[model samples]
Target: MFDVKIVNGHILDGTGNPWTKLDIGIINDTIVEIGQLKDAPSKETIDAEGLVVSPGFIDTHVHSDLLCLRPEVHKIKVMQGVTTELFGQDGISVAPVSSETKPIWQKQLKGLNGDIGDWPWESIDDYLSYLEQSDLIGNNTYLVPHGGARTLVMGFEGRKATKEEMTEMRKIVEKGMEEGAVGVSSGLIYPPNIYSDKEELIEICKGAARYDGCFVVHIRNESNKSLEALEEVIDVARITGVRLHVSHFKVAGELNRDKFTKSLQLMDEAREEGIEVTFDQYPYTAGSTVFHSILPPWMHEGGTEKLLERLKDKDVRNRIKEDFLHNEDYENWVRNCGWENIVIASVGSEQNKEAENKNMLKIAELWNTTPEEAAFDLLLEEEANITMIAHWGDEEDLIYGMQHPLQVVGSDGIFGGKPHPRLFGTYPRVLGEFVREKGALTLSEAVRRMTGAPAQLLRLKDRGLLIEGYKADIVVFDPTTVKDRSTYEEPLLEPVGIKYVLVNGLLAVKDEQFTGMTAGRVIRSGVATPVN
Candidate 1:
């Protein structure tokens, strides 16, 4: 008798193989059999008669970096059939921080990761071990953030690293890999990381590559300078012999939207030249991040407190505003999308909570102040503790970019003040709109993007595929009924199609509801799972 039997389903199998009618049986945490299983005895039998069973979605660029600590992790992720996810993305995260650097990271990363009570986060291994030992809902994977590595070795100064400092940074990357990171990641627009020259990044990637890690980057610019940013990462991959992956690759702003094809062709050309590269993207036409990220990089110098001090100084504030006036070197997200399109996604305090889901212009009117003054004061009051979703993408560009073979699915998803609907709707939306409706990709192709492709990148041989010996991480959904219910006005509504999800053979979601089974594991690079 099998522990759990899923019967009469059309299986996609995550391998880009054609859908085949099969029944999958699981015992403990591994699939015991795959084929006809009529009359099979089991503790549970999921009737997947009209469902499409694919491997549970693997979200490769999630900012749920700290959600493993709370029960909400199950609610936000497992309900959407996300059985595994990559955290520590975009180069800023909590691991590898010291007693002194912890405070700085908490402040710098406040927008991405809210404050945490006392938890042992001294090293990347400590953080991973804590998750492994906890009641986590999904398999958690991590990349050593280059932002944290840079801050630890050189502080947040906007200057090139010395040779010795570069060596020290390499050591931090080496130690993070020993702690079991799949790779290293960077946010080039963020502080300290912005200070790193190409030479420094190459050295960082070299260090990560010694442990067979890839470099996942949030490129320097995605708007007007998007092509140039692509060239920079391609250069890193070519020169350092490192595998490269772009996090949420997109061309923003109306001026550069048409260059989308040229940008992707550049990556294709790089592959022809033997530089390995791939990219991830969400289906939505909007993007989310810290509200203060739109400011000139110089404004983020020193640290969050110093930046807050500058924001309060009228002269300094005016000087910074002039950069926006001149359309300076910075990739100002607000200017690219227009201030009215930048809506408040989250806030730091209760008093400011009323501004949640409201745009900057709207918030300004409520405060009886100019939008400029309101933006500055909001940053100062919250210590730049705000996040925003900018409605900045072009539809043709989005569909074109997502259709490329190099593009895989990732939810640059976050949870906080009025989060982007992508957080709740990414996987289902692609299934419903892209595959089921538009026919942009077949079901097998989309499943491979979310599953087999990423599992190959993470070097997980057994998890992503739904073969007999693989781990029992699976999703069952109705192709006809699967649809994303979340929208801009109501962002947190659960998706409608996924009926059941299992994490390591235990039911995490059944009948589209969480089953309170936190049976997920922490996956580290080069760590072997006993497969039979």
Candidate 2:
């Protein structure tokens, strides 16, 4: 008998093909049959009349590294129909940490990934093993963060690695891939990763390529130097033969908007040259990240603690202000998008909670200080745990990227106070606004980007589709009614029209309510099962 039967649904199948009317039968954790299954015996049956049953969305980029360990808080992703998520993004995350570096990473990542008190695991294998024992709402995969790997060999040092140190770092990454990381990810705009030169990236990519792993990166620059940044990573991929994926790919700042087309042309040229490359992007004009990123890379040289110490210095503050105004070498957030366009999204301290949704300029006005000082003071008070949203592009540019053949959906969601609405609304927004409302993309094509495309990129063997023999990771939603309700003002509001979701064939969400059943497994590279 079937474990669960879903009948009267239009199946999209995640293959970029038009939908077909069908019914699905699930037993245990796999889809046992896909046909007319209305009379199939089952423990539970869902009448998915007028709903689209497609593969549950795979979030290719997320900052849920620590949040995934906390079952209650992390269900937000699954609630929005995400059945699997990729963590260890932008070259920094939990896991593979030494006792000495663990505290440092905890502070550095607190604003981005949140602090869950103390982490109990120290390696990729240990971290995945812990996830195997946790009550996870959806499946999770990881990348060997370049920053974390570098920290294991050298504790957030900002200098070139010697020959021996380079070999050691490569070994660290190779070991992580062996432990089941899908790839290696680096955020070139962040510390440790920002310190790495082109040669260092080639060495790291070589290690990941040994396991046929992909190299996912947030390239060095996304504004004025955007095209040059793309060329750098493309060159690394060419040298190492590592599968390359860009994270939250976008050209930031109004002045840099014209470079978007040229960037796409470069990616196309690389593909023509037989270089395997792909990218993920959220459907938003603004970008979000830790507020400390506004400071120059040199300020983050010694890690979060040293950064805080430097922030307290008058001379350092002066240097930082000068860099924010003039630096074109690094990602100058303040210069690309003004302080008025940069709004505080979240803060770690209750004392500054009122500034959550206010722009830096307004906050500075309230504090009766300069915008730079207000930013510095906030970082000092919060000990560097602050998140911000900077308005970067227009909807026209967002739609242009969305229509690209290589693009996939990744929320790049950062949690905590007045978070980007993409955190809660990304998937539905695409399905509703882009696909349904605007006709920017067809429904079948949109689902493919969120499902089959990412699944193929990550090398998930049996997920991301609705084939009879595949795992039953599915989402049932009303096409007519599905839409994201979350906004900048009401970022916590849940999306509408995602009626049911299944993870590993277990009903995790029914009628938009969580079933409290944690059937998620820690998916590893080339395998759908947990690490054993």
Candidate 3:
């Protein structure tokens, strides 16, 4: 007898093809059959009469590095139909650290990745092993973080790495890949990573290339110098022959919106020249990240403690204000999108909790000070543990990017107080608004982007497709009524019309309610074998 049988559903199969009426049979954790199985005996049966059955969605970018350790909080992803996620994004995460660098990274990443207290894991192998032993709500994978490696070798210094340091960093990356990292990632706008030049990046990409791993990057500048940033990574990919994946690709700011088309042209040219380039984008005009990211990179040279010290000095604060106003060399969020467009999303301290969900301008008015001063005080009070959402791109640009042939869906979701609505609504919004309402893309194509495309990119041998003998990770939902209920004003609301979700042949979400089952596995690169 089969372990479970789901019958009478229209199967999309995650192949970018039209749906076919079929039934799926599961035995243990594998999809045993996918044809006529209505009369087949099974231990359990699900009647999915009018639902669409497709492979469970894979989130390409997420900040769930520590959150995954807490399934109660991490189930939000499964509630939205995401059964797998890629972590170690933006070149900062919770692995491959020396004991000396652990506390420093912990403090620097508290705003973006919430604090989970001290753990005993240091290397990528240790971290992955910890996940394997944890009660995970979904499958998790990781990329070796560039900043983590840099800090491990040299303690957050902002100078160019010497030849010996470069060799050390490269070896760290190679070890991570050997320990089962799918790729290497760098956030060029963040500290330590920002200190790296093109040569450093080339050396690092070569390490990833040795294992045929992708080089995923959040390029240095996404505003006025976006094209140059894109070209910089493209050139690295060219020189190192590393497969390249750009993270949350966009041209931010009103003045830089016109550069969106040219950015796509560059990507197309790169692909034409035989670079395996792809990108993931959230379907939104506003982007969210740590509030401290708005400051100049130089200010973050020595780590969070040093950054806080600089923030206390009057002269340093003034220099920061000047740089925010006139700096084109770094990403100047204040100059591109004013303080009015930057809204505080989360703060760590109880004293600063009132600032959450308020724009910097509003908070400034409430404090009777300039917006810059208000932000500085908040960062100081919260110990730089704050996050913000900035309204940057246009809806038209977002749609155009979504329609690109190489584009895939990623929520870029960060979990915390008054977080971005995309955290709760990205997948549903794409299905309901982009597909059912505006017809921007067919439902099949949308599912393909969320499923098959990311699977191909990550080189998952058996996941991301609804085929016989594959893992039974699947989602069942209604196309007519699926919609995202979360908004910027009410960001915690869950979605509607996701009927059921299954992970590893077991029901994780049955009839729209989570079953409290922790059946997830830690997927290592090139280690997953197809279930026969």
Q: Local error of candidate 2 at 501, Å?
A: 0.1
The 10 consecutive residues of candidate 1 with the worst lDDT sum are 523-532
Q: Rate the local accuracy (lDDT) of all candidates.
A: 0.86, 0.92, 0.92
Please give, for residues 1-532, the per-residue lDDT of candidate 1 as tens digits. Answer: 8999999999999989999999999999999899999688888899999899999889999887776667665476888889999988888888888887888888888787766665577799998998888888889889989988888887788889998888888888878887889889999888868778888888888878788788999998888888888899999989878789999988888887766888999999999999889999999989999888878888888878888888878898788778766663667886788889899999989989988899889999999998788889898888898999998888778888878998899998887878889989999999999999998889899999999988887778689889888999999999998888988889989998899999999998889888888898888887322111
How many residue pairs clash per model?
Answer: 0, 0, 0
For all predicted structures, in order, the TM-scores are 0.97, 0.98, 0.98
Give lDDT tens digits, candidate 3, residues 368-428. 9999999889889999999999999898999999999899999999999999999999999
Model 3: how far residue 431 lies from native, Å: 0.4
**Candidate order by lDDT, highest to lowest?**
2, 3, 1
Scored against the true structure, residue 247 in model 3 reaches a CA lDDT of: 95
What tens digits encode model 2's per-residue C-alpha lDDT throughout 1-532?
Answer: 9989999999999999999999999999999899988987889999999899999999999998888877778888888899999989999989789999999999899999998898999999999999999889999999999999899888888887776777888888888888989999999999989998899999988888888889999999999999999999999999989989999999988889889999999999999999999999998899899999998999989899999998889999999888988889999999999998999999999999989999998999999999999999999999989999999998998999999999999999999999999999999999999999999999999999999999999999899999989999999999998999999888999998999999999988999988898999999886323232
Model 1 spans with C-alpha error above 4 angstroms: 527-532
Model 3 residue 14 lDDT score = 93
